[model samples]
Target: MSWTENIPTWQLVLLSIVGYVYLCRVLRYRRLQQKHALYPYKNREDFAKMTNQHAYEIQKYLFGVEFPFTMQKALEFALFRTYGIPSISSLLVKTKQLSEKQFASKRYADTVVLISEFMAWSPEAERTNAAIARMNYLHSLYQKKNLISNDDMLYTLSLFATEPCRWVNRYEWRQMTEMETCAMGTFWKSIGDAMNISYTPLTSSSLGWRDGLEFYEELHRWSLQYEEKAMLPSLDNKKTADETTALLLYDVPTSFVPTGRAIVSALMDDRLRKAMMYHPPPSYIQTGVETALTLRKLALRYLALPRPHFLRHDIISEKADENGRYHRIEYESEPWYMESNTRNRWGPQAWFKWMGGKPIPGTEGGLYRPQGYLIHEVGPKSQEKMGLREFEEGREVLMKAGRGSCPFSIGK
Candidate 1:
C-alpha cells in the first residue's frame, strides 16, 4: 500500500500542518539572517555606536552641506514627528495632507522612514540601539575620568542621553514660548476664569494636584529624586556644555516625557474615551480623529487590542451549513475589552508586522503557539532582548516573555 493510504487520516493532517510551519520558519530565519548580515557586528552595543556615528554624519550633511536651514528644519520637524508609522508611504501621504507646506519636498519627505510596512522596523529604532550603545561608552569614559558621579552618569546615560531627537529650526524653537508649551493643559482648565490662567504657567509640569487628579505624581517624584547640573569638560574631554544643558532640561528622561497626549485626550475627556470604547474603526485609530497615535511610537493598533484575555461568559451554538456539517459559531459577541491591558486592537497583520515576527494580540504573559509540531511561545521580543528604557517597553516585555523563556528549554 502507498504510504499516504496506509497512514491514519489524522496523522496525515498533522503531517501537512507540520510541513507548512517548517517552511514558514525556514523563510523567517533567512530574512532574519539577511538583516543580521547587513550590520557590521554581532554585538548590539557596537551596532548602536555605528548608528550614532551615522546620525552625526547625517547631522553634518544637513548643516548647510546639502540644504538651507529653512528646508532642513521643515523636513526634520515633519519627519521626526511622523517617523515610526507603518504603511509609511500611506502615512506620508496622510501627513502631507495634514501639513503639506512643511513636508511637500519629495526627497526629505520620503527619506523619513526605515520600514513602511505594518510590521517592520522604523528608521528611528534601527538607529536607537546604536545611539544607546554610544551613550554607554561615553558614560564609561566619564566614569573612568571621574568627570561625573556614578548616579549622575547612569541616570544621564540611561535616561536622557540615548533619546532619539531632531533639531528644530531656531525660528520654530523660538516661536514656542513657555506659555504655548505649557498651554492647552492648564489653559484649558482655567478657561472659565481667564484671569487666573497667568498664575499657572501653562508649561509647568509641577502642577495637576490642584486639578484634583494628581496625575503628575510620577513626574513630581522624578523632579524630587534628581536635580541636574551642567559640568563642562575640557577640550581633550568629550563632554560638552550644550549636551549637558539639553539633557538636564529639554531632554528629560523618556520616562518623564508625556508621550500619550492622545490617551489623555481620550481618557481625561470622558466624552472622547467613551466614544473610543464604544465605537468602531476607520476614522482614527479607534474611530476618533486620526491626528496621531502610537504605542510608544512602536507598531500601533486601530482599536485597543484588549489583551489580558477578555473574559466572556457567552452562549455557544452550532449552525448547520449547506453541506449539513455543523460549524461552531459564537453569537451576541461580547468583545470583553480592556484598555490598560497589553493588547490593543490593530488589524490582523499588526502583531507580526510591528514586532519582527511574533503573535500579535496575545496575553500579558504571552501566547502558546504551535510551530512545526512543537509548541512555541510566540510574542514580542523581551525587554531583556532590547534593554528598553521605560514603562511602555516594560509592558511589551511582560507581554512577550513574562511566563518564561523558550518552550523547548525544559524536560520536554
Candidate 2:
C-alpha cells in the first residue's frame, strides 16, 4: 500500500484491474482441480470398482464439458488410424463404402451417428442398447462372411481407448489424470465386450485384468505391436486415405485446401503417413502447426474459463422427436441423419453450402433423407429393412444381460 501510494492514480488503477483478473484466473483453475478431486485416486479397492456409471460421469466431464472440440478431433483421427491398416482398408474398399467420395461421406456420417448414440447416452439406457444392437447386426453380416478378423476388431477398439488420452496429453490444455484414463478404458472395454470382440490377444486376457487401467495398458502395448506388423503402405490404404482426406477437407475453402491437407499430414505420425503413402508436410508448415497448437493449449489452460455444465456439447440430440426418431447434432460432409427443416435448409450455414455448390438437405428429394433417422435403421440403404431380425435378437440379448452392467461380469 505504501509503495502504491507513491505511484500515480492511473498506474494504481491498472494494477488493481490486473490483480483482479489474476485472481479470477487462479480461481478458474482451482474449480477444475476441485472437480477432479471428486474421484478416488488413492483408494485402490474403490477405484477398481469404478465401472459404467463412474466412466459415464467422467467422460461427460471430459468430452462434453472440458475438451469437447478436441475430443471430437481425436476420435475423428482415431477412425483415420484404422484406414492405415491394409486389411481394414481392403475390407472397406470391397464393401464399396470408400469407393466414392459421396459414399465415403455417408459412411462416415453413419458411423458418427451410431457411435454418438451409444457414447452420448447412459450405458444402461434403452437408446444405448438399441444402438449397440444395430451395430452388432451390421457387423454380423461381415463376421458371417469371415471378412472381419478379431485382431483387427481389437486394434480398432484399442485406438478408441488410447488415442484420445494421447491426443489430449499432446495437444490439449492438460493431460488426463490416471483416473480419467482408467475411466476411458473401463467404458470402451464394456463396448468391446458388447460387440463380442475377443480380447484373447491381450497378454492379460488369460489372467483377466484387475481394473480398467490394467486393461488399457495391456491393450496399448498389443496395439503398438499390431501396428508395427500390419500397417504398411499399399494402394488400398492410399486410395481410402485420399478419399477420406478429401471428405474431411470438403468444408474448407478451395484456396486453402493444400494447407488443410498439410495440417492433416502434420497430425499423422511417420508410420501413418507412410502407411497412407502421403509425403511429409513441409517442415515449415509442420513447425507452424505444432506451434499454433502449443499456443492454443497455453491459452486454454490459463485464460479460458471453465465450460459450464449447461454449456456442455452433446454429439446427439437429447430427446426423440414425436415420430420416435433422433437427429445427429453434427455431420462431416453430408447430413445423413439430420432433419432437413427450414432452419437447416435456409440457415446462415446453409448459405455457405449453396454458394459452394455443395449438396444441402432437402435439395435431392429425399436422397439425403430430409426426414430424421430411426435409431435401428441407420446403415447402408440396402440394409434398411434387412438387419431388423438380427437387431431384435441382439436387443433381446442385451436386455437379458442387464442393459449395461459391467461388461466383464456379463457371462460370470
Candidate 3:
C-alpha cells in the first residue's frame, strides 16, 4: 500500500491496463497448448489412428480460429513459392490463366474456393469427397499427358505441408508446437495419397516413418534439395511470377503500388527473388518492412485480444444454399463465384468496393458468375461442362476406399 501510494496515479492506471492485456490476450496460445497436451496425439499409434479427426480439429483451431488471417497469408506465399520453379512456371504460363490479366482474379479465387471446399468441411463430409474428386480428375488429365512429374508434385505437396509451420514460427506471436506440425504433415500426406502422389523418393518411404514429425522432417529436406536444383531463373518463371505478384497487389492504392511490391519483395528470400528475376528492394524499404512485421508480432503477443470463437474466420459459407451452391466468405481482388444477392450487391462493404471501382458481385454480369459455385464446377472454365463421369467415378472410388478414415489404416 505504501509503494502504491508512492507511484503516480497515471502510472498505476497504465500498469492496470497492461496487466489486463497480458492476462486476457497474451496467454491464449499457452492455454491452448495445455489443452492440446491432454489429447492422445503423443503416442505414434494413437496419432495415426486419429489422424484425420485430430488434424482436422487442430487445423480448424489454427486456420479458422486462432491465426486465420496469418495462415491464409502463409498459404498464399506457399503457392507463390511454387512459381519459383521453372517447370511449374512454364506450365502455368501455358495454361493461360495467370498469363491473362482479365482472368487473374478468377484463377486465384478458383484456387481458394477449391482448396477451402475440402479444408473447411469435416473429413468425412460428402462435400469434401466431391471436392477431392474434382481435383483428382483435373490433375489426372495432365498426368496422363505427362505434363506433370511426380517429383514436382511431391515438392508442391511438401510446401503445402511444411510452409505454414515455417511461416508461423518465423513471424507469428508463437511458433507451432511439434504436435501441431506433426498434425500438418499427417493431414497433407493423406491428401497426397488420395491424389496418388508417390513417396518413393523419401528414404523412409520403404521402411516407413515412425510418426508425422519424422515424415515432415524428411520431406522438408527433400524440398530444399529439389529447390536448389530446380528453381532457376528463366523468362517463363519471371513472366508467371510477375503476373501473380501483380494480381496479388491489384487491390492496393495506386499511389502505394510500388511500396506494396517492395513490401512483398522484402518478405521473399533471395533465392525466390532471383528466380523471379526481381531486384532487391531498397535497404530502407526492407528495414521498414521487417520492423513492421516485428511490431505486428509484438502487438499480437502483448496487446491484441484473443480472437473469439464466434468471430472465427469463415473460409467459405458454412452451409450450402437450397440449390446446393456455396459462396466464399472472403476473397481478394474480385468477388468471383460469390452470390449476387441484395446484401452482397449493395451492402456497406459493397459501397466501398464501388468507390474503389472494383467489381461488385451483382454489378458485373455473368463474367465473374455471381450466381455462386457448386463443388464440382470449380476449375478452369473449359472443364466446367466436362469430366462429369470421371468426377463421379473418382468420388465413388474415394468413398469406397474410406477417404475419411485413418490414413495409415486405409490399406491395412
For every model shown, the clashing-pair count is 11, 0, 0
lDDT of each: 0.26, 0.83, 0.81
Clashes of 1: 11
Candidate 1 C-alpha error for residue 44, in Å = 3.3
Per-residue lDDT tens digits of candidate 2, residues 1-412? 5877789999988887678668757876786678768766545455567767668778778889888888989899999999999999998888879756758887888888888888887887878888999998888889899899999999999998899899899998878877888889889988888899999888778778777787888899999999999999988998898888898898899899999999999999999999999989999999999999999887887667677889888767788889888876656577666678888788877788889887777777777766778878888878877888888888778766653555444442
| Candidate 3 clashes between residue pairs 3 or more apart in a chain or in different chains | none
By lDDT: ranked, best first:
2, 3, 1
Q: What's model 1's lDDT at 301?
A: 17
Worst 10 residues of 2 by lDDT: 403-412
Q: State the weakest 10-residue window (summed lDDT) of model 3.
A: 403-412
Candidate 1: which stretches are off by over 4 Å?
A: 48-412
For residue 158, give model 2's deviation from the true position in Å: 0.4
How well is each residue in 1-412 modelled by candidate 3, as lDDT tens digits?
6889999999999999879887866478677766588668766556655566677677777897777877888889988999899888888888877766876677788888878877877667778878889988888888898888999999999998888888888888888987788788777877788788989988878777656677789999999999999999988878877778887887788899888888889989999999988889999999998898889888888878788789988878888788878888666778887778888778887787788899888665667777788878888888888899999998888777665555655542
Q: What are the runs in model 2 whose C-alpha is more than 4 Å off? A: 1-28, 37-42, 407-412
